[model samples]
Every structure is written in structure tokens, then in C-alpha cells.
Target: MTLPRLFAIAILSLTPGLTAHAGGKKGENSGISFHLQGDPSDNPKMIFEQNTAGKQVVYRRNPDFMTKDVAAFNSFPSQDGQGFGVVLQLKPSAKNRLAALTSANIDRWMLAMVNGRKVDAVIIDKQVEDGYLVIWKGIGQAEIDAFDTQVPRIGEKKPRR
Candidate 1:
């Protein structure tokens, strides 16, 4: 392979890894990429907007666990003040912090059921809170069900004192 071609391939491959760390000020989780927007100041904002035309699943850090999961994720604003959000906890939080970036849209934030049960996919609607909202989909029904139940729970670390 030519030197120039080899160099090009190397850069292209590393591109994903580099972008993965982009704006990682919040956390580093695997199988997750988010398209965020809107300020949390508002009650309900377009937190996670989906780009794909197909259905999507979205997850946000549970508001109740904001201060709890300080290192896991951070809170922003809803920008609208009338939206709700769901938290998503990656099994291996240290696997792939950044996979691929997606486009966010209004009214794409939702945690609904696909096969008669609540799923983790947020759908990237405009009813979610701001901060770092990830839009994921094509997940199994079982996994989605789990996320719907308590994936957002940022367990309280025992008192350090």
C-alpha cells in the first residue's frame, strides 16, 4: 500500500475513536451516541433528537440521581420546561464511550414499550430534559424492559465518611 493511502486509512479509522472522546465531559459509556440540544432551563426541551427515520430508543440520567451519578452523567436544561427524561446505565460504562453521532430532533424524547412493555429507547423526542441525552435503538425487548424498569437508577454510593 502506498504511504499516503496507509496514512489516510489510519486517520480515518482513528477518526471515530477521536470523536468518541469529543465532549466527553459527562462520561464514557459503550453502545451509545447522542444528538443533544435545547437548554435545561426550560421545563421540557428537545434533549435527544433522532436522525434515523425508523423508530428509536432514548435514555437520560434520572433527575433523581443527578447529584448521585455525578461522574456518570451531568444535567443540563429542558429548554421548554414540560418534557420528561429517562436515565440509561451502560452495562460496561467503560467500553465504548463514543460509537457514532446522531442527529437530534424535537418530539423525539420518549421511553415507551415496543412489544407491550416499557423500553429504554427514548425516541429522541422534544419532551426530554437537557444535559447529555443518548439516542439508541435496535435493542432487544428484554434489555429495553430492564432499562424501562431501573436502568436510570444511579445507586447511592455509601457515605465516604
Candidate 2:
């Protein structure tokens, strides 16, 4: 299969109750989703062909990761001053999702989404013993802020937009 199709399959498999909008309904709300993409050891490339609003875009996926338990989001200044970072805290019930990952998946990219819009992607460099995930790459402060504002609370349904 082509890369995009395979990528879609991988994403679909990871996120339950979520469907890709590439050809489906124009605006399906896929609240807070994650997927792994490509080999962790390969060079990463930005997905220019999927651009929108003239902004460069990249696709990410995590084939083995899945969850619907994002408890909260907060932003903090990057230590080196390059930019800001967003931290995702998973609920207690969802902590196992992080534990499921192993060193074999280290360096793999974790694709994050809010309401079906690709928000951010982070490379998995180590096992997450704690439920706190610091996403410091593949997104800017603006995107992080938007995510904080747009994401629905746990057990809340996303409104149609």
C-alpha cells in the first residue's frame, strides 16, 4: 500500500471511535488523538503536501499507542529559550497507555490531534514512567494555546464546528 494509505490505517487502528476526514465527513470531531509514524531511527521530514493556510504541515502516528484520557494541558517556557512547551497529563486510568510503550519504540514520533486537526507530534525518547508527557517539539506556543482552549474536558462531547 502507498505510504499515506498505510499511515491512515495505522492511525485508524490506534485511535478507536475516530475516523479520518480525508474523504469522510468534512468535520468529524476526533478529540485528543495520538498516533505513531515512520521508523524512529529514520530522518524526519515535514509534510509539505498536506499544508493548509500556507503553513507547513507534518503527519504523525503511533500504531501501538491509544488513549482517551488526557486530563489536562499546561504550557511553560522552554529551558533553552528556543520556544515554549506543552505538558499533557494523563488521567490515572490512562497511565497504562504510557507504560505499554517500551524502549523499542524510543525515538518514534507520537502524533497528537484535537478535534481531528493535527496539533503536534513528539518523538518518544524514553519510557514514560509518570503520566506527565512534555510535548516540546513539532508545535509552537500558539498551537499549544489553541489546543488548551479547544480541547474538551474528559467525558465531554466535542461540539460540531
Candidate 3:
């Protein structure tokens, strides 16, 4: 085999590893965000998307809330034992906005997306009076780690070191 051909093969093999490493860095795509269902009506702010079940869902182009709005969080084992469930406490401003959004959009779907993937969806049955939002399941360790880095866990103290 020619030297140049061997060098090309080596570089190609390393490309995937390098790309994966870069993507794994904190604050890149690791944070969580929420999007609300949009109406079928064509609006510039809304976009069409398909959920994990392949059902067509319409949602706003921007998220209703993101990691920045989180004041703290709590994680627990899912009822079905599949993965962890997380409860996110939003900041005051985001809390009011979420309450209004949920109250106004009752019966619509609210999606929880992590690492740019739609992880779970819930129907807005009632208005959220408190600032908390729950992602029922499908959270993995990587996501938990990302959340730890981005937001503090509820009642956790700062490290003395």
C-alpha cells in the first residue's frame, strides 16, 4: 500500500473519534429544553416535527424553557424502572411563563428534549401553579451528569474543596 493511501485511511478513522469527543464536551448539546405543541395553522414561529413514535407534532421553533431557566432539579427512579425521572424547578420569571403557557395550552403536548432528542412528551392537563416541571422517564446517566454540570441539585451544598 502507498504511504499516502495509508495516511488517508488513518486520518479517516480518527475523524469519527475526534468528532464524538468534541460533541461530548459540556454545554454543547447536553442541556435540556422544553417545547410546546403548535397548532396546525402555518405560523412563522412554529415548525413541524415528528416525535419518537413517528406521530407528527408541531412545536415552536424556539424552546419554552431551557437549562438557563432551571434553578434546581431533582431526579428519581422511574415508576416503570426504565430510566430516571427528573423534576426541574424553574426561575421566577420562567415559572410564571410556564404557568401561563400550561394554563393557556391545556390539552396540548409538552415535549422534553435532551441532547436535541425528544425524550418524553406529556399532555398539559392542568396549569402548573408551581415552578416545577417533570420529565417522567427516559433520562440516562449522561443526561444526569450534564444536568449536574449545568444546574445544581436541590439541597446540594457547594463543595468545600
Candidate 4:
């Protein structure tokens, strides 16, 4: 199978109630993907993917290593669906939904400038190449920062065993 096809499969495998937007066509199954990037010996990683239906899929394949339980604190939509100067990918009322739902582990974070001042912040830890993938969503800045801090840095060399 092609790489994109396999990548989609791997993502689908973790998302329980979520479905890929890719057209359901032939040769769409049986593909391999590296859910998380790391040596698996040090600085292990976690993976989470979701669909529009709020069905979250998760996976952890740290070879010969242990992982901490992924704690979810929030998943509410941004206020006004337009925080940080960008529209939220979720629905307008989704932010309220996140605020209402107690099961969702999500949080609200802020993008700030260096004002030489201490302000509320949120740090989402994950291998963020383009968009926030794994380490899906946390509730507040502290939660996001705490969880994100656990993610390994990109291209960071692993420690010797």
C-alpha cells in the first residue's frame, strides 16, 4: 500500500469511533505507520487521534519501555471559535461543549508574546510538525504545558541505555 494509505490506516486503528475522511476505496487497508517518533527506549511518546464524531482513538507502542497513563483534562472548543487569531476546527458551540463535558480531557491555552511578564500559559507537549496531533487537547495552560512537557523534542537524540 502507498504511504498515505497506510498512514490513514494507522490513524484509523487508534480512533475507535472516528472514520477517515479519505474516500473508502479499494487498496485502502493494510498499511503501516509509525504513530509516534522516538527511540522507544528513552523519552517515550503517546499518540491520540480523533474524528469529527468525538470518538477518540489512542495508541502507545514504546518498544521495551514503559509509559505513563495519558491523562485528559479537557476538549472544549475555543471561545468564539476564533482564538489565537485562527478559527477553531471544531464547531462554534464546541467550546461550550468542551466546557460542559466532564469526560473530555481538554484545556484552553493562550499564545502570548514575551512581555517580560508572567501570564497564564498552556504548553501542549507532542511532536508538533504542523498541527497539534498527538497530545490532542488539554483544558488549561498548566495541563497542556504539563502534558506537552512529557513529549520528546523533535530530532532530539535519545539517551544511551
For this target, which candidate reaches the highest lDDT against the unseen true structure? 3
Ranking by TM-score: 3, 2, 1, 4
Following a full C-alpha superposition, what root-mean-square deviation does model 1 have from the true structure?
A: 13.7
Flag the better candidate by TM-score, 1 or 2: 2
lDDT of candidate model 3 versus the reference: 0.82
Error of 1 at 61 (Å): 25
Please, what are the lDDT tens digits per residue for candidate 2 over residues 38-147? 43344454221233235433444332333346666666776666666567677776667676663456866666655555555666788887876665534565555566
User: lDDT at 94 for candidate 3?
Assistant: 96
CA error at residue 83 for candidate 1, angstroms: 2.0
Query: Model 2 scores what on Cα lDDT?
Result: 0.56
Each model's lDDT = 0.36, 0.56, 0.82, 0.29
lDDT of 3 by residue, 1-161 (tens): 99999998899797866755664553355478898988778585466575645678888757899988988898999888988999998899999999899999998988898877777889899999899999999899777876787677877653111
Better of 1 and 4 by lDDT: 1
Report the lDDT tens digits of candidate 4 across residue range 1-161.
99999999898898845654446532232211122222224433342232213433332332111112122122344454422111122223433433333123233222221111111233323222222212222234443344334432233333111
- Candidate 3 Cα outliers beyond 4 Å, as residue runs: 1-28, 52-54, 157-161
CA RMSD of each candidate after superposition: 13.7, 11.2, 9.1, 19.2
Best by TM-score: 3
Model 2 scores worst on lDDT over the 10 consecutive residues at: 46-55
Give the distance in Å from residue 3's predicted Cα in candidate 2 to where it truly belongs. 47
TM-score of each: 0.22, 0.46, 0.74, 0.17
